[model samples]
Target: MDWKLENIILGVTDVDRAKEFYTQSLGFHLDVDHQASDDFRVVQVTPVGSGCSVTFGVGLNGAEPGATKGLHLVVEDIEAAYAELEGRGVVSSGIQHFDVATGGMAPGVDPEHRDFMSYVYLNDPDGNSWHVQEAHHKGAEG
Candidate 1:
């Protein structure tokens, strides 16, 4: 059997607001937006080049808005990703590089651009957080 992760559910106070944030601010591709009834709706968006998408809607998520945390998005070029997001007018925690020797984090991308060492954090309008990490390996290495 093949097991593949597909979608994540995000709780949002307003569906249209969240949709605009994801589609316009964060640049995710809108996959679906369906309203089954006045109380039920579903909206899905996928990041560019990502196989997994995120869904948010009315009556679909029971968790509190902004409850989801620590979701990750990996990229080969940390600085480029940061620049693109910044250019899009998205607010972020700025790039931070992790020190393997002391496990300390400091501002700016890794000097050597090591995989999994550089990161930036972003939050949606509802404050659902996501970690963007520089990972050249792309999970090919064990």
Candidate 2:
């Protein structure tokens, strides 16, 4: 047996605005936009190369808008990812890394380029925050 996460529900005040933010600004692929009536709607989007999709709409869930935090998106290179987001006009935090010695944080990518150390954060239009972390993996030497 296998378990998988297919979607995440986000409570948004404006469905179209959320859709646009994910699709246009964050470069997610629009998967679905269905409206059955005036009170109910569903808009789903998936980030590039991601199997999990984000769902937001009217009458979907009870979570408060902008309440979702610490959602993570992992990448191989934090600097490249940050640059790409900035080029797309998305406002994000400058790259920062965790200090293993002091258990604190410092500016810029991880000094040793360790995976899961470097990070940057950004928020959606509704203020749902996301953390982008570097998770690089080295290939086995032949």
Candidate 3:
């Protein structure tokens, strides 16, 4: 089956707030914003090179708009990407080493120690957690 993913819903408290965060902070491109009704609207955005887009609007089914921590996005170089993002003034937790028990590589083995890759955590405007990772075997497409 040739299935292409279209959108992933992102719950946000305010449409405008989420819009700005995706556009200005995460550098996602705004694809659509349409009012579905008097009380709701649909806004969609795509990361620069991602295959899928994220949508948000009023009263999305979930807790008030918030980011899910540890959502992983793979990159080629963790350190370089970290530096660039830091330069852009994005608050980062800095690159962290993870053990398999913490959802990393192997049990009791740190990714940083073995050089499998590196990772850093960041947040969107409303504290949605994001994990930026660089795999030693793959090159960054972004």
Candidate 4:
């Protein structure tokens, strides 16, 4: 059996603000924004090359606004991704890596740019955090 992940429902306080942030700032493709009534609204947006999408709007889920955290968006090039997001005016944390020995974050991407080692973080209007992780391995060494 093949199981595919589809939409992730994010509870945001404002629908229009979240839509703008995802569409304009993050460059996600706006898939849908439908409101049948004042109590029901659904907005879906997907990243450029992602199969999974995110949905947020009024009365969709009971989750609290800004409750989601640690969502990862894997990318092939950390530097390019960082530059693109920064150029688009998204406030992102400087690329950093986790130090296993000290269990702390170190400045800058991993020296070798190893897969899963480098990351840059950003937050949406509702404070839902997203991590752009470098997941491309150049070769056996990387």
Candidate 5:
């Protein structure tokens, strides 16, 4: 059986604001915007080259605005991703890597640009954090 991850629902205080951030700042493709009533609205957006998409809006139960965190978006190049976010006025942390030898975080991307080693973080308007990581080995079969 094949299982696929599709949509992730994000709790957001303002759907329009979230839509703007994702579409304009993050450059995600706006997939859907639907409102059944004043109490029910959902907006879906997908990152470029991503199969999975995120949804946010009103009337989704048990979702607290700004509560979601640690979502990862993998990129082939951390520098390019960081540059794009910066160009869009998104405040992102400097590229960083965890030093396994020293067991501490260090400034800059991984020296070797190793998969899963380098990351930069940005937050949505509602404070939901997203991590962009350099992952060059994804989908390669052993």
Candidate 6:
């Protein structure tokens, strides 16, 4: 069995705003924006160099305009990313740390990872939320 991460669904209050955010701020390329009905649109975006894609819209299987949460995007740099977002008028939700001692946000992020990692949250006008993560610790050696 080969299970692979395919797509993420990001529910946004406004499709245009979400499209602009993902494309302009996060550098995701718009793949598809299919309008299936008068009440909904299917907007998909793919990261510049990623096989995974995220889809957002409305009226998806009881998914209203706002019905997504806790979506994580693993990134390479946190500080530079913060600066870019700031330049684009986006605000951070404060720095979140991982507990190194317990592997659960130990008084800030682990020091071994250069202590340069953190997550800053942002929200759209309709309260749709997303965060930028600055570290990659998948195999326990990152």
lDDT of 3 by residue, 1-142 (tens): 8999867887677788879877876678999999979687888898878888888887456545564556677666666777777776778778775665657533221334334346677877776678876665343221
lDDT of 4 by residue, 1-142 (tens): 9899988999899899999999999999999999999999999999999999999998886568999999999998888899999999999997898777788989887777777888999999989999999986465146
lDDT string for model 2 (17-131, tens) is 8888899988999999999999889899999989899999987865789888999998887888899899889999889999988898989988777888889989998889999
Cα lDDT computed for each candidate against the true fold = 0.90, 0.87, 0.70, 0.89, 0.89, 0.68
lDDT of 4 at 139: 50
Candidate that would win on lDDT: 1
Predicted candidate 5 versus true structure: per-residue lDDT over 55-125, tens digit per residue: 99888764588899999999988888989998999998879988889988799978877788889988999
Model 2 misplacement above 4 A? 137-142
TM-score of each: 0.92, 0.92, 0.73, 0.93, 0.93, 0.70
Task: Kindly provide the TM-score of model 4 when superposed on the true structure, using C-alpha atoms.
Answer: 0.93
CA lDDT of 112 in candidate 3?
A: 43
Model 6: pairs clashing at backbone N, Cα or C within 3 Å: 98-105, 98-106, 99-104, 99-105, 99-106
Q: Please provide, for model 6 over 1-142, each residue's C-alpha lDDT reduced to its tens digit, 9 standing for 90 to 100.
A: 9898988776567788889888886678999989979887888999776778988887755345556655666666665666777777776565566665566543334455542356767765555567667666443346
| C-alpha root-mean-square deviation, candidate 2 | 2.4
Model 5 C-alpha lDDT versus the unseen true structure: 0.89
Steric clashes per prediction: 0, 0, 4, 0, 0, 5
